[model samples]
Target: MKDGQEYLLFLTPEQDGLFGTRGVTFGKVPLNTEELEVSEDQIESSHTHTEKLRTIFNEGRKKYGK
Candidate 1:
């Protein structure tokens, strides 16, 4: 992930400094494309509405203590 670039990361629990289990991977992507400093190998898809995603993510983080 790039510094100050907002990225949504879908990560599994870390093991030995790596996320996910064997043969599995997740994505970390920023919605805003204006400052895209780099690209990722895999990017997960989501609903296009940014506000809705914010609500969901915020609520989840609050409730789940992540």
Candidate 2:
């Protein structure tokens, strides 16, 4: 990678280190594309946005512990 280049990473937690979705080949993708595709969708949530975030954080704390 060059000095100023940026990339998007898809990673999974590992005991040794984070690994890509499918080994090194699927690790990262360059974000320097001329045209990038984006899509937006709306979904219903049981909790308010802040409450949803708090719920997520609480779940993480349960998994990894505080």
Candidate 3:
């Protein structure tokens, strides 16, 4: 997803990563910020949001003791 271009992610109730066997993969995105309007700060912010999601998943794992 681009920094400025908005998008929506839909997650089903059963698809919750919490307490599940599903594995989460964090991919490495290679982008050239010079060609786009997106800035390094904006990209960092987006990654921070994903970090929060990872934190949530970690918490869920702890809670479920999975």
At residue 25, what lDDT does model 2 achieve?
27
* Residue-level lDDT for 62 in candidate 2: 47
Give candidate 1's error at residue 24 in angstroms. Answer: 9.4
TM-score of each: 0.33, 0.36, 0.31
The positional error of residue 10 in candidate 3, measured at the CA in angstroms, is 14
Q: What would the per-residue lDDT of candidate 3 be over residues 1-66, giving only the tens digit for each residue?
A: 467532222233354454321322222121322122334554455767756655654444444432
lDDT of 1 by residue, 1-66 (tens): 557655456666676887752222213334444232332443234445444444555554454432
- State model 3's lDDT: 0.38
Best by lDDT: 1
Q: In candidate 1, which residue pairs get closer than 3 Å at backbone N, Cα or C atoms, i.e. clash?
A: none
lDDT (C-alpha, whole model) for all candidates:
0.44, 0.42, 0.38
Ranking by TM-score: 2, 1, 3
After TM-score superposition, the amount by which residue 10's alpha carbon in candidate 2 deviates from its true location, in angstroms, is 0.5
Instruction: Give candidate 2 misplaced runs (Cα > 4 Å).
Output: 16-22, 34-66
Please tell me which model should have the higher lDDT, number 2 or number 3: 2
Candidate 2 CA-lDDT value: 0.42
